[model samples]
Target: MVKYVEGSFNEDYIQTLGVNFMDKKVQIKSTNITFLIWDLGGEKEFINMLPLVSNDAVAILFMFDLTRKSTLNSIKDWYRQVRGFNKSAIPFLVGTKYDEFVELDFQDQEEITQQALRFGKAMKLPVIFCSTSHSINVQKIFKVILAKAFGVKLVLDEIVNVGEPILVYK
Candidate 1:
């Protein structure tokens, strides 16, 4: 996945090039298209550290565990807050775990999925289900984001196709 600094420039910011500088403070590049990814720490204590989101943010990928109904419940409020901060109707929604769904309690899974679908309609965002551990549709997530970012369509040719052009750095 891509990584970038969350806040404004500081003394810690460094300049470098290519894969050799993977650990640089800020790294920017393009495979098929340029990605200005911002990595925000998922810590409750860092609530005050809201990074400045650009007007051109084509998508907002909100991820959560499908087994956790509590987290899914909070998505609506989070969507509300994000909408308040960003008036743009960017494509944004929850991404649930794919493989873990079968292992989770049936009630929790159903409840979260139902809530997600409801909020998705209310917020007009597309909910993308994924599993990073099994590599299940993880790349598709980026493809959706990039397609939305560029305003295009992603076509699938076969049952397990990575679309027409698979541009993966790793």
Candidate 2:
């Protein structure tokens, strides 16, 4: 997750280095809040550091792969771990790889969405479907997180003026 945000997308998924965790400072655009982002590795060895890293997070983003059901199932454990550290941490359930999920059949897509929706409702957390490769809903996810964390409303360009003209010809 940190790698993706740091603009390194072409790297391999496997962890070759010995680094278990990383921290980066990220400034949310149009706002003064700067998040000290922590990317914790999921390896069993790094599990012990969860309490140290997750305890201070303002918002926790639990990301799962849309194409991988196991990843979705693992969210329960992740949520429990994060909550164990800091119950006040606002958590957001995110489903990644929307671009790949689009190639799947309707039944598969529906099943995943329904399952995620049920889980989100049960957890009382907002759910988002996004794709880093396609840049789908990536910014919106942060905007929502910022809003939830700090009660700041982002100015969206998509808001339409109802009384505005459709076209202007000179």
Candidate 1 error regions (>4 Å): 2-32, 53-56, 156-170
Q: What is the C-alpha lDDT of each candidate?
A: 0.50, 0.68
Q: How would you encode candidate 2's per-residue C-alpha lDDT over 1-170 as one tens digit per residue?
A: 54345645443566423234444455656545555666666555767778877888888878788888888998998888789889998888888877888788778777777787778778988777777776667767777777777776656443112121111100
Question: For candidate 1, lDDT tens digit of each residue in 70-97?
Answer: 7666666556655665667465554545
Considering only N, C-alpha and C atoms within 3 Å, which residue pairs clash in candidate 2?
A: none
lDDT of 1 at 133: 52
TM-score of each: 0.65, 0.77
Q: Over all chains combined, what TM-score does candidate 1 have?
A: 0.65
RMSD of each: 9.7, 8.2
lDDT of 1 at 48: 42
- State the number of backbone clashes in model 2: 0
